[model samples]
Target: MHLPEIDRYGRGHSPLHRLDPRLKLPALGVFLLATNLTWKLPLAALFLLVAFLLTLLSRLPTNFVLWHLRAPAALGLILAFLLAIFTPGAPLVGPVTREGANLAATVFFKILASFLYFISMVATAPLFRTIQAARALGAPEKLLALFLFTYRYLFALLDRARNLSLAMQARGFREKTDRRTYELKARLYALLFLRAYEETERVLLAMYARGFSNPRVTLPQPLTSAQVLRGLPLLSLALLLLALNFFW
Candidate 1:
């Protein structure tokens, strides 16, 4: 299968792209941990700034990064609305209380910071490399294998579904706000599931035929001194955040 444009950007010759995936992966973990633990807005803003710098260092398209953030931004807004309406506190403005607004704002910034951190981490390396790095960091092999398979097949499944939708459209299938549309969608979903099951069976058979009974194990490449040094800045930033969380 052809690589998606979003995935293709990871192959760029940038500092972040060049960092060892093992180093990057753990650094991302610490960064995320620090971000989640931070409650103060100033600290969260710092984390966001770090995420932005990392994005720039990765040399990914700015528009692509912004587009990628849209889902998280939408979800954050929804969460803020729910918190403002549901959280119990004395009213500050309209239905929203001061405490509720503060909590919602905190959650929104936290989610935004996390989304940016993830995009920076994932965009800096190919998917397979990220999986491998997770394995190297002692993630369960079975879990990693599941992640690998899902990532590998998600696009293919989407393509199959798209083709099916296009074929239906060509056959004059017009969706409407009615029972017929719902029934057609249900049938389409069932057919997609069946096709996916059959494809999975074929893949398993092919794997068995090739004597692939066990998952192959390979050690991740060791990080060099220079690579470790290069990663120290991220680590230091995470530590600084953690220190602030504890002391501030």
Candidate 2:
């Protein structure tokens, strides 16, 4: 029912936090692309280091950023493990090879670097504001609206599921490693999905009744010359990394 708080670090006074999302979004995109395109492991490490410095500039707690990377880091490690096993080259140790090691290291750096940049840019801003910025950059309005609504009300949907769970518990339902429990859980999930669909239809009808036909979406403020110029450094960094990717 109530909007959930998403901008946990938005209260900080960092320049990155204050940077216009319109500028920040594009810079983050270019930075992520450049970092991923880098083939050299050393260049990838350098790119990650730069992303870390940007996180520092964001003024979010250093530990918080690292914490955010935990899931991605775990997935990256798994990916690296698979790549090291599957990709063939001069044998290093057992099945692992020199090429695979290089490839794994590159994957690690790219994943960590991209996530760090995202934390610096997105975690420090209001999520809705960033979504708004996406619109300013010519993203599709209908898709954006669908995403924003889905994300915004996700907690409510989860709450509904939880309440259903509690109701089941009140009726003496006990979870166990049994076929019946699995079937019951599946049915519960199906019921939740059906409820979600019904809620969405009701929401659509309400919107139509409330004059949402041809709704006027609010656009972000226009950027000025100074604001546009201020983002040049980030753009330059992206270009510099892209150029480095071509070197020995």
Candidate 3:
């Protein structure tokens, strides 16, 4: 089962990549909150610039970030279009109302800002380390465990589905826009579910046999003064944005 790589750029020597996740996670939350709280165009644009700079600093590929943004961009366009046609306010140009246009622009910038922050904060870290940070931040134990297990098995499930599709193709199965194709896809889903259930049962039994009671997740090394110093720029940026949101 081949899994698609995550955080491909995370192994780089960039300082942002090396920053501790425990600090990064909280700063990300604050940044997201600050961006969402503001409707001012200039402030939103400032947040967008900050997000772009952070992404560049992380050293992730430009194509990777843009590719991941397509969905959000599409959704933003749809929202803007809806607002232009449906919002109640004085007309700005043509049939578009001033209030709706303003609202749409705000939503678009907010989405862009939040998406870039997510890429910088979450996509730049190894999955396990992110989970560790979540646990350190006092995430509920059951929720953490569930998240860990889901992430661990997600690729395996994708691999299984890919293999099944390949086998079907080798046996001369070709999809058509018809009932037969729908039925075949339905059966494939059922097969995947049954396989997943059996695999989960086996794993649970193995864990029980190994006496895996109260699984303990170890915390990362204690944050040093230097690490805190290195992370101050991000924390300060978030604080500044929060201040601007409230006082500006």
Q: Could you say which candidate leads in TM-score?
A: 3
Q: What TM-score number comes out for model 3?
A: 0.90
Candidate 3 local lDDT, 7-107, one digit each (tens): 76656667688888998999999999999999887888889999999998888888888888888899988988897778899999988999888888888
TM-score of each: 0.87, 0.88, 0.90
How high is the lDDT of residue 237 in model 2?
78
lDDT of each: 0.82, 0.84, 0.86
Q: Please give the lDDT score for candidate 2.
A: 0.84
Native-to-model Cα distance after best TM-score fit, residue 76 in candidate 2, in Å: 0.5
lDDT of 1 by residue, 147-166 (tens): 77787788889888888898
lDDT for 18 (candidate 3):
83
Which sections of candidate 1 miss by over 4 Å? 1-6, 85-93
Query: Where does the lowest 10-residue lDDT sum fall in candidate 3?
Result: 1-10
Candidate 3 regions with alpha-carbon error over 4 angstroms? 1-6, 171-178
Order the candidates by TM-score, highest first — what do you get? 3, 2, 1
Alpha carbon lDDT at 3, candidate 1 = 39
